[model samples]
Target chain A: MKIGYLGPKGTFTEEAAIKLKKFEKCKLLSFDSIVEVLDAVDKNKIDKGVVPIENSIEGSVGITLDLLAFEYNLCIYREIIIPINHCLITNKGVKLSDIEVICSHPHSLAQCRKFIEKLGLKIRSFQSTAAAAKFIKGKLNYAAIAPKRAAKLYNLHVIQENIQDYKNNFTRFIVVAKRDHEFTGDDKTSIVFSLEDKPGRLYEVLKEFAKRNINLTKIESRPLKLGLGRYIFFLDFEGHRKENKIVDVLDAVSKKTHFMKILGSYPISKIYESNSLKK
Target chain B: MKIGYLGPKGTFTEEAAIKLKKFEKCKLLSFDSIVEVLDAVDKNKIDKGVVPIENSIEGSVGITLDLLAFEYNLCIYREIIIPINHCLITNKGVKLSDIEVICSHPHSLAQCRKFIEKLGLKIRSFQSTAAAAKFIKGKLNYAAIAPKRAAKLYNLHVIQENIQDYKNNFTRFIVVAKRDHEFTGDDKTSIVFSLEDKPGRLYEVLKEFAKRNINLTKIESRPLKLGLGRYIFFLDFEGHRKENKIVDVLDAVSKKTHFMKILGSYPISKIYESNSLKK
Candidate 1:
């Protein structure tokens, strides 16, 4: 099997892809951007592609949600949740006190804002955390905020571990393919819909799930770009698409929406057991 | 009056601030970051702070929402919606064919991506659009994606206007102060709350507004940072807290959520009338 991921290697996405590889041995391919990986998956160039869906701290990855909603017809085959343990990495023998500059992706920098502020250092943003890790190779005065694995891969020493301001940081990734997975008892169904401009339509539509005792896992609203107050909602609920209750709920909800699209139904992630090893 | 804005000057936030200044004269002080501006308002260092709350294309600004939900005690006093018109700015006498590089904030770069890609120039990122405009001064080969106002402020020339990928882009800014505005008859209220982890708690809370025929303008769910599937909801509805129906809705809704905070109530923006001249 062939699987693609967003990478130049040594990214959290790659780590998630590697974990997915154990379920079934597959050749892992790295793509430059998230769109490229999803596009490759959609065109059958790769069997499946792994990309981040949401972060515990950052909330949902808007581009991923938007693409899955409007641009792609792909289905989520599996879900993976990984801890985002940012480490302070520097060149060998470099001390934390000697570092005058910090570098990382903007999100990583934002996540570690409190730590950086206390350190009183200048910040530089790289396109990716892995790139920042690689860039600090011979720069003794620069420390990077990246995953610990990147430190080992890039031959850098980790000066401090788990430097993110919040200890509970985690990113949820999804494997997308042309078609979704079959019934998995413990699964989640993702869907997006736009309610007619009538007040309370959202409340009425959500009642279908509530009345059926279907628990919602996530809910997000994105502007349709038509204007403010105009929105399309994306939701994830605890059920497989093949389940009878899910079918009934979708039918009821669809009737109340101007339009609806089922993005996917996939098993809930259980990667914390293995991710603990890295932490 | 003293007001704070996220700026180095010549930014969209400053543009929003200038529009606000028309209603009542105020001295606009520039801050390095969103947190600083909001923090200043919380400490009463400034009478008010103007910060971007949401973009029509980018959705909600997570930092702004997170701060209001968790850290700060300030209340939103007004709402300002302005059209985001990106321009291709360069030094005077520079031709389109002479440009070899493009520079701007990441968000601005992403918004004008298609235009830049068509031009096939190397991209550079700056801390802000205003900074990028300043950096390209006297460099004929470099073009910056910024607001036209910046071009005038920095004595640059606009080679092209409205270069964003989408034409419907708009950003909503909020004026935050120690106290919220008195009801203007036509106003909107914002609130954030966490539901009590029940399967249907959200539906029940939303029903309070639905039953009263109250219209919701925006609904967003952010991760509580406690764990996956845990969320704190931020909502804006079309009524002031002073309204009888709004008071009843808040009372009913508060009884359902584990915790709740009323962010503010203020007049909705109608800045399109004034912003059209800039567009």
Candidate 2:
């Protein structure tokens, strides 16, 4: 088996990919961007790909969601949730006062805004936190906000641990493949659909799930980009598409919606169990 | 009067602030971050603040949304929508082939991803697109993805215009103040609320508006971050809160909700009129 992920190694996406039981014996490949990973999967360059979908604090990763919605013909095969802890790391002999600028992925910088502001240092954004750590090697007057593991891998000293604004920060990642997963008893069906521009069309569509007692796990709307006030909704519900009840609800919804696409049906992630070892 | 906007000047937020009819004769202040802009408004440091809320291509600005939901007591007074156009700017006499690195705000970079990838240049993220243009001053082998105004403001040459992936890209900006606006004939009411963890609670809440023939313009759910699968929804619908029909709907929803906040009702924006001259 071959699996692709966003990396230069030591990224949160890499950590999530490693924790997957099925990928334990698979060959791991690293790509520079999420778009590349998904493109590789769509073109069969790799068997599967893992990418971050959303962060508890950062909300949706727009690139990931947009790719799945319009650009890629892929389905989510599994989900992974990992707790995020950012650290401020510098060269072994460097003191905090020596740092003139801090570097990290833009999201990491945003998450550590409070701490970064307190330090009053200039910020430079890199492609990833891990990339930021690697960039600061042998460089003077520079530090990075990255995962704690990055400090060990890059031979840097940690100035501070858990510097993110929120302690419960977590990121959700999804494994995408050409084929969708089968029912796993405990599953989530993800779909993106556009409603007709009538009053209460969304409310009417929600009734399909609500009347069937299908609980929604997530709901997000993205602009259609045709104009203002136009949107397409991405929904996650607590049932597999293969389930009879869910199929019935979808069939009814198909009649009401202008367009609908089922991204996948995959098992819901068991959080803490796979993450316990990391702590 | 004084208006606060995300700035270093030459940002989309700054443009939005300048277009406001109420702020035509008012002084405008630029802040480093959206949080700071809102904080200034909350503390009466500015009479009003303009911040980007959503983009046609990028979706919601999570930081802006999160700040309004928590840590602040402010109401949206007006909305401004402006079409976004990115330009590839470089030092005078520099050819496109001379560029070795490209810099811009992450969203600007992402919007021009195809162009940047085609050129095979290294990308550096800046706090704002305008900041990236300013950084390349007297520098060689660097190009910036910024607004066309930045090229003229910073004495750079526009190598290519409208380099973004989408031609119709637009951003929606909101003017926030200490108090809400009075009803205009045409208005939009924006609210954020949390529902009880019941299966049909969301449906029950939507019915409050739907039964009254009210139209919903937007609906987005952000994780409460208390745990997995918890969410707080931000909704925009037609009709002012002062209307009897809308007031009754709010009363019904307040009862079904665990927490509710009315961000405010304000007049819908007229697009293109203010943006026509910028083109």
Candidate 3:
């Protein structure tokens, strides 16, 4: 009945956590860092924890992926895909022309680069979006680039909405628990593996999935930490581990590589595709 | 002749530029940003510009790769690989025990996490390693985690050398020019392409290289900037583009992908592999 999220309360992760299934009866707690939230899940301190796995604009969240691959023993319970909409918020009664400076998290500022560049205002990076919103609560000339939820939470006036550089901007969040969700009939499985230092080894591994007609939703590589050119490949494919075809694909893949880990099986989010969020 | 680097001087790029072929005679000019340096090369303001393309621990530099692919018309002229060694530097006669804060660029600070955690000192992030070194010049009880070259340039004492968590750390720097180098007989080719988003499409493209006995030195994907799950693939292989077999591979690959670009060919660096850097 308890869930954890990366937060000082008003973050995208918190927004995703709020939308979890049957959240009306659950309690939510905020953790300062992603690792802390995941660690809490691993230790049973929180029933589940939510953290961002990837961004449409920024790509993968390297730290979250690294923790799941190497540091922690947890499986994804569910996924929540939401559109990342950044709005410019300021103190009440402040006109757009009155704003002399803007502030937000580095990622937010980067996401709204075009809008900020056009405004020709000095920008500063604060710790979080909500924190910035709170900092500019009583200030007339400063604005915060954050979400509409943050504006509501901080009692700020919304100056503009959806000011990000890209309209299709979205982030994929994963809920991690001690064990993965059971067969949902329609699910996605995530796995990570590394191959020997040889040519075509990756091609050989992909052949297993291709031959079985398995659709890989995502494919990425992270530095294996030994040196350059050495990577641990991460793949997300459609189908739960309980499925017969996936079992065969997993068996064939395990034999070809040196190391592999099954991160989880969870139901595909409704907003998994960028176009799905469109009206 | 003039060579440009990403710098205000006292940077790893500056060090790599100083060691560039016949560089003792070439005048060096420092640019404020990576794109500016590459833009200078593209505009013929500088003969060539040096920028970090990849790091053994951090993976690819996306901006450099993207600029070469879509924004600018430039090619790889040469590659310089050097070990990234961070040292704890302090103002003259300052002792390690007297240091209350450490400072460096965010990447450098992240690279030396274990060392910083052991010291248990407050940390600050600056614009660059050399900039941080300059900031602590006459301030007692302040130290900078920067390269040894920065220590020398800033007239600071090296309290300790090779203080990074990973000693095998190295960065790959590429020289960009208006035209790529002609065949050195032993050269490498780099290319980027985007697929049509179908199952087994990537596998089919890799088959072109595999069947032809082409050894892909590096393969990575960057977000195509359109949305998530869409990527532009980059490949580095062991032959110049003008080579017959590589030409055939490119011909075959061009048919498989919607778009492709040849980033260029240059002689492979001597320290391309981490193990080769061993004394």
Candidate 4:
């Protein structure tokens, strides 16, 4: 199967994509923009595409939500949550003090702001952490804050590791395919809907999920841009869409909401199991 | 009044602070981070502070919201919505086509994503758009995307002007101070609250605002992290908290909300004739 993700071969998204598949021969394709990655999956350019949905430290990835709203046909088929560990990587012979300016993705820089500020070096930003590490390997005066795996891939030396502001820093990525899947029997579903500009409508809709014992994993609201008095709600719940309880809950929600779109139902990701290599 | 904003010389936030006051000796102080700027105001280290709250293209500044949530003693006193125009800047004599990579703050880069993608050049992120312009002016083979004023400050050549993706791009900055000011009688108020996780509870709360004909300009949410089922809503309304209608609405809605906090109320920003000079 052909898979697409955001990458230049060593981004966290690439790592997550590779981890999602078990087959050795899965064809992996990289795209620069999230829209292109989604388009590739939609037009059958690729069978599925993996993109980041949210980051623990940074909150939700707004672009992903906006795209789901813009591209109405795509559905999420699976979910993966990757533990993120950022490190300070530098060229072979360089030390931390040798660096006058450090570079990395904007999110990474923000996550490690205190540590970087304590070191008194200027912060720079790159498109991705991997690209920053690659640049550090080529330039002696530069150091990069990136993942440990990226440091290894680019042969850069690690000056510090696991430097994020929060210990539970993680990014949730969802795999999207053109057609819907049968929930893997044990799955979760996501949907976006808008409440009429009326009182108690949101509480009533959310009550359906709570009463059914369906736990919500995420909820966010974005402006409809039609001016004031309009909003759209994106939600994630911990149950399969095909389940009777969930179906009934959604049906109840349909009555209360002005517009509702089911983004997808897919297998829920298990926590990552680190590799155990045998000598 | 003494005011704190960001500056070394020519930052956009500095320009905004200057426009906030008419007197030449308005006691302007430059700070480093959004937190620092806000803290100075909360601690009464300064009379007030001005910081960018939202941009037309980039949405809300997440850091500003986070700080506001923690510092309940401070309130939003005023707002300044500034028009933003980014230019492609490089050292003198460098042509646009000659640059292989472009750099800017992530928000700036994202705002111009479509245009940058059309140019088909790699995007690099930097500390800030102004800093990126400064770096590009001192280096080669690079162009920085930043406000036109930054290009002039750094002695860089503008290869292209008005390069943002959206023409109507504007950034709304809020002036924050210690408490709700005694209204000169025409002002705006901000509040944040959470609803009981019941359907129609939020709907009921919204109705109070609607019934009173209060125009809400913005509404945003953040995870309460109180675990599983809580959320906090940030809101901005057109009238001051002291207005009879607004006071009645707040009292009527207090029964429906689980928690409510008034962020403060102050005079709405008046039209500034000098803001037109930035272009």
lDDT of 3 by residue, A1-279 (tens): 899999877777777887874434678899877878998998889999999998877667777888899889899888888888888999889999999989887678767866886888877656568878888988899999977778878888888888998767888899999999899788999999999988898899989988898988888887787777788888999999989999999999999999999998989887732221121
lDDT of 3 by residue, B24-64 (tens): 47888999768789889878899989999987766677668
Model 1 residue B264 lDDT score: 89
Q: Each candidate's iRMS in angstroms? A: 1.2, 1.4, 1.8, 4.7
Q: What is each candidate's fraction of native interface contacts (fnat)? A: 0.58, 0.58, 0.48, 0.14
lDDT per residue for candidate 2 within B97-141, as digits (tens), equals 899999899989988888898889999989998899999987789
- Between 1 and 4, whose DockQ is larger? 1
TM-score for candidate 2, residues paired by index: 0.96
lDDT of 4 by residue, B1-279 (tens): 789986544566766787866533678898877778887887788988888877755566777776787544678877776667677888888876788889887888877878887888887776567777877766778999887677778888888877987666667788888866678676778888888775445556777877677776667776553432356778777787777899998898778899888888877665343243354
In candidate 4 the C-alpha lDDT for residue A55 amounts to 73
User: Highest lDDT, which number?
Assistant: 1
Estimate every model's Cα lDDT from 0 to 1: 0.88, 0.87, 0.83, 0.75
Clashing residue pairs found in predicted model 2: none
True-vs-predicted CA distance for residue A54, candidate 3, Å: 1.2
Please list the residue runs of candidate 2 whose C-alpha ends up more than 4 Å from where it truly belongs after superposition: A21-24, A272-279, B21-24, B273-279
DockQ of each: 0.69, 0.67, 0.52, 0.26
Better of 2 and 3 by DockQ: 2
Against the hidden true structure, what lDDT does model 2 obtain?
0.87
Q: Residue B22 of candidate 2: its Cα lDDT?
A: 45
Worst 10-residue lDDT window, candidate 3 chain A? A270-279
Worst lDDT window (10 residues) for model 2 chain A?
A: A270-279
